[model samples]
Target: MTHAELVFVPILGRGHIVSMVEMAKLLVGRDPRLSVTVLIMKLPFDSDFDSYTSSLAASVDTARIRFVHLTCENTDAEISSASFLTNFIEGSKPHVKRAVAELVDSAGSTRRLAGFVLDAFCSTLIDLANEFGVPSYVFFTSSAAFLGLMLHLQSLQDEHHVNIAEFKDSAGELDFPSFTNLLPTKILPSIVLTKESVRSFLEHAKRMRETKGIIVNTFDELEPHAVRSLAGLGAPAVYPVGPILSLDGETKKKADGSCGGDDIMEWLEKQPPSSVVFLCFGSRGSFGEEQVKEMACALERSGHRFLWSLRQPPPQKGQIEVPHDYADPTEVLPEGFLHRTAGLGKVIGWAPQTAILAHPAIGGFVSHCGWNSTLESIWFGMPVATWPLYAEQQFNAFQLVVELGLATEIKMDYRRDFRMESGVMTADVIEGGIRKLMEEAGGERRKKVKEASEKSRKALMEGGSSYLSLGRLIEDILNNMPLT
Candidate 1:
């Protein structure tokens, strides 16, 4: 048997890292002769490597799959001031250059460096792979439609129609014939929407052209137009392997060394099927005090069962607080809200999102529209109440709610590139959408969304478009790529 070694480097973020891990697990399981290494970022707050290292060890033999830590203090004031973490994979070329060199040395001579798979924003990895004469795969870490929208951003700029300074201003729709005029700069990826951040986005686009192979975590049938559009871009090959969840298909979160055991599923199981709404606003999106209060009021008003993932408290001096009259659903939530809504709701700090979404009882998702969360919602065949929080979330929301007819957007316009700081979707709006999605009165909405859910399931099943893509990706791209 031929032996090969592959390295997976992910931009440091919860969602991106998780996706990389899933792909890694799938690859190792498919090819016994292949050895894999995962390079994980060492954040200051996380002083030990046990948590990440042990998870991989549990999945694969320690000898075949290993974890290496890249010790970088991401807290450098300059890096933080420049928002490097948010833009790390795209703009921080210098840092990535050094990091890659260090990794190459650590990898040693035993295995030839095989083709590399990295987050889409990690365009610098393309250069690193070229330097080593290795092929590279770029994971877009977003919807295929969103990737198509980003690829067209440069064209939008070249046309001189996107006014970066005034993108936040009420500019009437710009023409995008390729997109059915569905995407507006205001609704494009958040990176493209900001005047201050345009340079980083341009750099990212320029670097993306270097990818030899591209992977999007989406099925072909889900966004056929976007998939075809991506093919038109210079990418030699594009693969859609999605609903790329890392969790086992099982509904419970069994404790696997070093990872915490949370009982979110146990709580979810008690609820009636199609009776509860699961709400989560990814890791980075946050709501101010006012928005939080509004959501509490709306959730209360809707009189529907809910499980809300509260935002971590803001770092500002004046912290946001829940309404005085609101009931606390858990000790983790602020004071009174739990006691008031004990029978009707539960608020957890962070639930096993994928497991919860896959639960039999979850009827709908109230999401921040982060790409990973959006896909998981669809994977579980649940309809969505789209509430965009940051970056490309608004763009994802536009596709899911308007173009795909799978969800209802809480608002039409987001606060201009204030990014996630624009605040949460208004509570009254949230209440209305939730009511329409969760109750019997939501009949028409349910029927339409249920159709989308069916399509999503069909896309991933046997003989499904995504299943074929995964086969091709493994057999054609991953299996054939030369390993050093």
Candidate 2:
């Protein structure tokens, strides 16, 4: 029997890399005849995935799933615009081409080239796939709803000549086929309002149409309307094979062990069931001292048990802004705030989010509305108070609050870039949102999230929606294998 290998090119970010790798694992695990070769593109700055990749390589079967790290020249140039990602990926074209050629030559007739699974940011690599005479599929790391919005916005620009930048100033709601409710302009991703970023996203959306299919990291049940709308659109076939999370916690567990793992779990164990609220932004989420003070005041006033992951914004290395643990969180936090909320609140530098959410004590989450965090919150049946900061997080927050009614709103339009000018969320607003999350809307949101959690798990089981979709995707890959 001839073996087949699908080449996966994932973005360098932790969330994207982990999710795509999990998808690759699922594919190879489901079919013994198939294998996956993930082309790891290292970012110019330190992304700190060395341990993760090393651990994963050791744990997985290398024969079936292997990681090929691509070498690119390092640049110390500062990345101030959104085009950096596009430019970096474009620059790696020659490296990608060389890697693919080497893989083809090494396989000879023993294994056939199946196809290319491109990350959302790497859509430009589709042309490379075309040159290699293999089908290309996009592994979109965000929600299906966001995917629909991207395509819709692209069409609006291409066909209708509608300017998305105008939405920044307009106080109007736009209707998109992907969502059931009217979307307010305020909730549009901050990137869409900027010329360069919008151009980059639109270009990605345009090229994504050239792929054989677009695989979204979402399940049908979670975003039914968005998933259904994609089918009617004229774009390529869409496969919703997800909630694809790295549930094993291998990478995080290692990090957690070094960072007072016992202390966090021990504190949680002491709290009463469903009483403590967890306030964690995504990995990149952090705030200025002004905002941090307000959050501390709010958590104190709310009189609820809490776990806050307060991180300091690391100095800009390149384009990416990673948040690091503060040497002393009290430096940024309010005076005597830690002492005041000592028993009720535990403010830590880094948190084991999934582990915390899984604990019985976690009642609700104050989250950044990042797709991975959103899915994890749902998986653990935790109601969320959306506090989106950057990227597509504002839109994700809106989808959860207004479109799906699964999350309560903290501040849907808050963006990191415009944080100072956007005005600090007052202590009262923060307190009210936390109260609403843990008390008022908690029951209904918990019920819905619990239901979604159950369906999400079932979706991966045999005979489930995601299972069938993955099977279909694999069949497509097998059928598209090049003849030797």
Candidate 3:
């Protein structure tokens, strides 16, 4: 057999790295002749992914899937700036170049160097891949809808010269090729309105056109319109091979036992089937005292069984926010709230989200609309109440609530931008949203999610859309292999 090697370059965050690794795993598992080399980059002040990566390394076959940590040099640039990720990835080009050179040298003729898989944020590295005479593929970690939106917005700026900043407060709806429904300007992601952030995003979108293909972390059944729209865009060929998730929950258990995996499972087992509403934000999701209090008030008034993952914001501001567990839940929550809703609700920090969503007792999800969380909810057939915070989440909320009708909207425009002060969402609004979500638990929305869940699973089976896409991707890699 002619061995082939593909190099994967993922961004520094946990979400991006994990998803990229899962994709690599799927690739190697599908073909014995292929192997993957993941080049890991570390952010200066972020939480370490050592334990998680170490655990994964031990469990998997080391020969097929290898992780190489690059030596990243610190820069004087401001860590909290919007362009931090881009700048960091750009600076690490030398390390990436050296790693790829070493891999090619060691492989010789027995294993041919196939291609480079770049993260969405790491598009600048495409130049380096070109330097080494290898094809590059982008691994987009968000929805295909979001990818289409990025390309659309890039066209708007490049061809039409439209200033997106002018639409900061516009109350109008705009049509995009990816979405079936018109998107309201109010629900646009907070990042797009900012000059610096949008510039970075558009730059990436433009560079994405130069890649061999873009692999999105979504299934075609879940976003048929978006996937089809992307195919017609004349950019790069898109491969929708996903619902790629870390479902085992072992990493979270090993990383932090205090995340309460066993305890949460025990509590869920005691509850009636399809009765508890699970409220968990993504890894970086957290809120202020006032917002936390209102959430408690709404949960108490709704009279529904609930599991809330409440995390406290970092002690200082103007830096990267790393939310931690509150010493006492009552400090941030309403006074006597825990005692009042003792049997009905359980508030813990750092929940095992995948496990919780998979449980039979979980009826609905109040999520931040992160792509991974959205896919997990769909995979488990849970109805969602969209409550987005930061990044592309606001746009995701709009897609879920207005476009797909798969989720009830808590607030499509709510954001927690560090640069500005967003108003606290009041208790009545949250209570109303919660009431609507629980009422539709067994209704049309639930039916749609269940059907999507089935399709999502089948998409990965042997003759499914994702399975075929992966095969095509592997063939493309082999065809692009550099001649000896």
Q: Write the per-residue lDDT of candidate 3 for residues 1-484, one digit (tens) a residue.
A: 7688888998866778878989998999999989999998877776646665677667666588888989965877777788777778878999999999999889866687788899989999999889988899999999999999989998898889998866777999999999999999887777778776778878899999999999999999889999999866656989999989888764245345454578889999999998999999987888989899899999999999999999988777656656877878888888889899998989988888898999999888999999889998999988999998888899999988888878999998888866444689999999999989988755988899899899999999999999999999988888888876
Candidate 1, which segments miss by more than 4 Å at Cα? 43-57, 60-63, 73-83, 86-110, 158-165, 249-267, 317-336, 412-420, 423-426, 440-445, 448-462, 475-484
Arrange candidates by TM-score, descending: 3, 2, 1
Clashing pairs in 1: 111-484, 112-484, 327-337, 327-338, 328-336, 328-337, 328-338, 329-338
Q: Candidate 2 — which residues are off by over 4 angstroms?
A: 59-62, 75-77, 250-260, 316-319, 418-421
lDDT of all the models against the reference?
Answer: 0.66, 0.84, 0.86
lDDT of 1: 0.66
Give the alpha carbon lDDT tens digit for every residue of 1-484 in model 1.
5446666777766678778777777667666756767776544433333464565457654466667665554444333333555444434445555755665676665555566777766666677777767777777788877666666665556455655536656455654433544456567555565676665665555566666667788877677777887666544588887767765632223346332225556677788988888888776555556666778888887988898877554444232211111133332344476678788887765466877787788888888788888777776667888777556778788888777777876664454223434545666787998887787435665676666667767766778777777677767655556655
> In model 2, what are the clashing residue pairs, if there are any?
none
Task: Give a tens-digit lDDT track for model 2, residues 1-484.
Answer: 6788889999887778878888888888899889889998887665566765777677675478888989864544345556677778887888899999999999866788888999988999999898989999999999998999999999998889988877888899999989999999888887788865787888889999999999999999999989989865556989999888877653245444564556789899999998998999877788878999999999999999999999887675223556888889889888998888887889987787888889999888999998989888878878899998878899999999988878999889887753213668899999999999888643776788889889889988899999999999989988888876
Relative to the true structure, candidate 2 reaches a TM of: 0.95
Where does the lowest 10-residue lDDT sum fall in candidate 2? Answer: 250-259
Candidate number with the higher TM-score (1 or 3): 3
Give the TM-score of each candidate.
Answer: 0.83, 0.95, 0.96
